[model samples]
Target: MIIARLRSIGKWIVQKQLAEVVVGLFVIVASLFIFPGADLGNLGLQMVGFLVLVVIRLYPGFSVVLPLFASGLWYTGMADHTLLSGVLAYIAIEFAVARGCIIIAVILAIEWLVFGYVVSRDFNPQVEDLPGVLFEFLCFGGAFIIGQLR
Candidate 1:
């Protein structure tokens, strides 16, 4: 019975495209290792945001609101977890492409806005944050374009 349950769980993961979920969790773990001083509460919030992105895979129609919700959680609770946002953005854009909808534009706009807000919140923009911000935007755009091609 236990083996049967394990097999069923594996099937569910395959059907749900949950490899992204596994990668997200790994990113979280790696973040913990990289930032040993990270706050537990902030990491917890990041985990929640990651899980919400996974939910988006299950309910593609919720793509609109879920990304916003996850961004809010990440920005307000833990702006340091930028990798989580990258993963979230990739998954959202892929979902939009899979659904063959123009919502991809909306998702891209939302991700850009969230990224800007987070970067501005964490850095002094009037000084020298432009290049870094532009690079980050390019990274996001690359993820979106790759999603489209996929």
Candidate 2:
């Protein structure tokens, strides 16, 4: 029964939003490769969380909360430690305009600073990895633009 249910769900997702589902999965895999030091268990948990968000994303009315959830995940270090910030940014900017993109970037940056330093108490993680942070930002920015276009 469970297997059949899962299969049906998979079929529905493929039929309705195959590209999105694939991209979501791709983000998970890419994050694993991108952030080698990230905890596997946390990544698994986050993947499950992402799936839930994706489900909400596909829901007509609940789609409004996706960016909120994604940004929340980003701040809490559950958004793949910002290594896959591009994916979250992409999701947030999927249907946004120019002003929305700026808002997303500002909000994401603020959360990254607050949670990464104050909440997680991980001081200076990016201080020495400035280049990496910049690269990730570039990817996130590019993905945001591409998502908006698509």
Candidate 3:
């Protein structure tokens, strides 16, 4: 019975597209790596939330919702990569669902606004922040391209 269950789980993973799972994991890892000084407590919370989305995404037809929900969660949470993950999630959804560029554009706009206006409020406003901003921009551009190709 255990073997049977495992087989089914394996099948589910294949059907769900392993690329998505890997992308999700990459996002989580990237977030943690980029923000080494982030509060461990908050990072833990975001990791859990992202894991939840990854698990939910394994179900057929559920991929469509996972990205949007993950994005929403990140946007509302204190995670260091909230904006990055949110943008990545939306782009991933575009790749998974083939949603039009317009939707992607809107999501990008919202992310830019939030990252620019809301999320920026947390920073200390120092010249040292320049690196983080540049890192985020690079991540965003790289993620969007990767998502499109994935």
lDDT of 2 by residue, 1-150 (tens): 999999899777644556566677787778778777877544644464355335534443343444345445544666445455445444434423222444544455444444444444443364666675677567556756765554
> Root-mean-square deviation of each candidate, in angstroms?
5.8, 8.7, 7.9
Q: Which candidate tops lDDT? A: 1
lDDT of 3 by residue, 1-150 (tens): 999999889877655656555766777677667766666544554554454345444442443344344344445664444423554444344343322343543344344444544454553356666676676567566655644553
Error in Å for residue 61 of model 3 = 15
Q: Name the regions of candidate 3 deviating beyond 4 angstroms.
A: 1-15, 23-40, 48-124
Ranking by lDDT: 1, 2, 3
Worst 10 residues of 1 by lDDT: 118-127
Q: Candidates' TM-scores?
A: 0.62, 0.46, 0.41
Give the distance in Å from residue 83's predicted Cα in candidate 3 to where it truly belongs. Answer: 13
Best by TM-score: 1
lDDT of all predictions, in order shown? Answer: 0.58, 0.52, 0.50
Cα deviation of 66, candidate 3, in Å:
9.7
Give per-residue lDDT, candidate 2, residue 122.
47
